[model samples]
Target: MNRHLLYAALDAAERGWAVLPLRPGDKRPALHGEDVCPGIGDCAGGHRKWEERATIDPDRIHRAWGDLPFNVGIATGPSGLVVVDLDMPKRKSSTDTPNGVTTFTALCERAGQAVPATRTVRTASGGVHLYFTAPSGVRLCNTAGRLGKRIDTRAWGGYIVAPGSLTPMGAYAVVNDLPPAPLPEWLSARLTARQASRALMTAPSAVRASRYAAAGLNAETASVRHAPEGERNATLLRAARALGRFIAWGDLPREQVEEALQWAGEQAGLSPRSCEATIRSGLNWSIARNGQRRVA
Candidate 1:
């Protein structure tokens, strides 16, 4: 048993964060997936996701962490925290690319406000996680690049590795000791806009003529949204290609299909630029191949 990790889990819970166990030196949850759920213990009622299984109880924490050197995962929704994850660009060596910190700082400057000095964690990949208290009466979901490039948020349906967690890249550690400040009004306003924009995307559903097309579109987007990290791009590409056939058959509009798939890819953690490129490529390939058959 790693006492240090045990302390870390307890400390987070002490601060009211719901904690869960992650694989040692990895970000993935240590809990069983629904596919292998034994229908006992936590899942006796049904399959409990990591978010539902997350707990603040010390006994649960101790029991889970005592047997292995498991890393800690904080379920942001249950903890009533919204964490802003500032990610580094994938191409670190390119000076042309801006990291999340730089873009976020510039965004704050444009809004005539400074970056809020809140509880902050420095991620192993040289990025930052700014912790904030979720505003009362408002439930926000996770977003990727909704604010800007390389900026993501973890709220309902999302989780983050706590300080003292280790991964192959490096360790997560607290950089600022300040208690989380209430989410800034400007940031909150932007998030609200995100919700509105998403609503607009669904407003065009009347254009969908076929139930099969609608079902296919919904299924593909859901697959992209829930895809694990390493598989996100491939899933997005495949989803776009599958939907392209519907577009060629005049069952769905190309613009609407592209927009929906793009948003799904971003929510699944792909960059906006990458999502657009992949979606375009996949749609082009599929439409070209399928359009000829339609003509024939």
Candidate 2:
């Protein structure tokens, strides 16, 4: 019956963390996918995603885990937790690049702050997850590498595989027993900036747009968003420079171009500060170089 696993689910529920059953020895949810939903029990009204279906009920937990050795998952948003994921290097043989831990430590140093002491978990792959209480009145979403290289965060619209889960790599384990700390202010500020940047991009601008300009902006932003991890910054810079000519010729507003590119860069996993700097540099260079070109 995997009594230990049942206890793990109850323990998380006791702490108010919404628990879900993961596939046995895997991190994916054990529940049926939306396409295969029976539209009965929980979905009588409509299909509910894993986040909405996650529950802290002891009875449900017992019913789900009492029959199989399924792993456990914690829906971070429902739990009011933001987990910073410091991932291991994708290629163990590649020692040239810094791991998530190294980059995150450097990020804290640059911000003039110490790493927050929080509830810590060691993932099956030897990565670290640092849990923090979400700040009041802010809805932070999942971000991939927005903090630093190989550093990701899960909040709203995201989940974390809880300790007591097993995978091909190894068992997830709790390394630090400390309760989650309130999210550090410096880190919170950065994440808030990310949110604000996205908001600015979506808010309608007063600038009139030509069909050509709109198409160009959409295409360039897509390129930035889908750029390979190693080339994200370069792609953002190239996109900004390419679109700066539209602004230079007065077909697009400077603010609109910058905001769109900024949002795209952030989505591509570049740090917000770095994205802003790169976009600015690219746009300025393009504007200056093309200032005298005549558009007929």
For each candidate, the alpha-carbon lDDT, in order, equals: 0.87, 0.84
lDDT per residue (tens digit) for residues 1-296 in model 1:
47999999999999999999999999878998767889998899988878899999999998999889999999998999999999998854587899999999999999999999999999989999999999888888777677888898888878899999999999999999999999999999898777666656534464644888878888898899899756889999999999889888778888778868877886775655678889999999889888843442
**Candidate whose lDDT is highest:** 1
lDDT of 1: 0.87
* Positional deviation of residue 69's Cα in model 1 after best superposition, in angstroms: 0.8
* lDDT, candidate 2, at 239: 97
TM-score of 2: 0.72
The candidate scoring highest on TM-score is 1
